[model samples]
Target: MHKTKISVDNIVDNQTFIPNYPIKMSIRDVDFFYGSQQALYNIHLDIIENQVTALIGPSGCGKSTFLRTLNRMNDTIPGTSLTGTIQLEGVDIYNDFSDTSMLRTKIGMVFQKSNPFPKSIFENVAYGLKVNGIKDKAIIAEAVEETLQKAYLWDEVKDKLDKSAFLLSGGQQQRLCIARALAIQPEVILMDEPASALDPISTSKIEDLIAELKKNYTIIIVTHNMQQAARVSDTTAFFYEGVIIETGDTKKIFTKPIKQKTEDYITGRFG
Candidate 1:
């Protein structure tokens, strides 16, 4: 294992972990709340460009809450509010765009369960393009094919493009949803326990797909599976009770966390 030159001396009081690359998104001192209850507290994280950043913790640790905050998905709920700055490429996403549709398109999301549309497989991939106002059928068809290929689901469903998306198996359906997300060509992808519902084989497939996707897209994934986070992420952040304890290179975070709290959680001491 390669140990980084970064030691306690360079970190934020030897707790906050930062990656060694240019940040695609910078989240600074963010706090989020639903009514009177606060779910996240002063989160400071950096997502590197064109790499997979994994968020791991026990349930209700605000990992998912933080993920939704990336694209402002939490705004859909009533009485939820956020304070602090979240910037993409130095531009404040919330302040820059009054209409979040463009933001949602720029940062796509995939959920824990496979939620394919009732429409045909082709239409599922084309939905984003259509909604974004691509009127040409040929363009949409080409995009669907390209996106399915990019999602690694083209071969399985190429012959069945006209069939309903619900006809696919659980794993295939998840990949279909990924294809849907990719159709719009998002710059960032946020996944919330994307493979938590699949079998081992299906989970392996998603893991491998995530590896391939990061070559082109910046990805931030929230996963309960420690092994999955270690397998696919370049950087990892450990969250507990709305606070980020550590964030660093995945190898370092898993193999040699600077914080005792992170070490205890990673070693199976307690969630």
Candidate 2:
């Protein structure tokens, strides 16, 4: 495992390996509303490049809502609005970036449930490249193999490229969706409880794949499993009632949380 010294801006000098990578996404004063209901409140978070940042809390605490705001995924819902700025590479996504398609390509998403397209394994991975206007068959084919290898799914499904994606096991389907996301060569990957439905062995595989992926792609994951967050993330944020209670290094957040609320929640107390 490699470690980067913590940046002076983070103010956590106690941790040995708090990432000093540049901020990949900067979210500030973000509030999200669905019609008359408010889901997130004045949220501020910085996602480090090439590191995993986990959003962990009980259900309906705005963890997923905050994750969607990173790539403007929440804009799809009707009667929803957001206030405040979310910047990717210093450009405000909500106010300045109008091209959602290109934004999505740079920041891809994987949902809690595996949502593989109704196509063959090869086509599933090739779909994004084709949609983005890559017409050359050789190029798409090469990209598919490289992406599947990145998602750690190539060797397992290499010989069955023609098989329908639905024929795969649940874990394989999730990995396939991840491969599909990677096929576009996104800069950041947002995962909403990606391994929540998997068995322990499958969950371990996903965790390992995440570890490997963070070497190049910045990752922001929303997970309810504290143990999973502790195991995979470089940083962790605890949300409660739509507000972030604590955010910092994963080890400190789990072992010596500065806030009592964070400690109580992680200790299996009332959420």
User: Whose TM-score is greatest here?
Assistant: 1
Q: Local distance difference test, per candidate?
A: 0.88, 0.88
Candidate 2 lDDT score relative to the true structure: 0.88
Q: Cα lDDT for residue 173, model 2?
A: 97
What does candidate 1's lDDT look like per residue over 109-157, in tens digits?
A: 9999999989999999999999998999999999999999998899999
Residue runs of model 2 more than 4 Å from their true location after superposition: 1-19
Worst 10 residues of 2 by lDDT: 1-10
* Residue clash pairs of candidate 1: none
Each model's TM-score, in the order given? Answer: 0.93, 0.93
* Backbone N/Cα/C clashes per model: 0, 0
For candidate 2, the TM-score is: 0.93
Q: Write the per-residue lDDT of candidate 2 for residues 101-185, one digit (tens) a residue.
A: 8899999999999999999999999999999989999999999999999988999999999999999999999999999999999
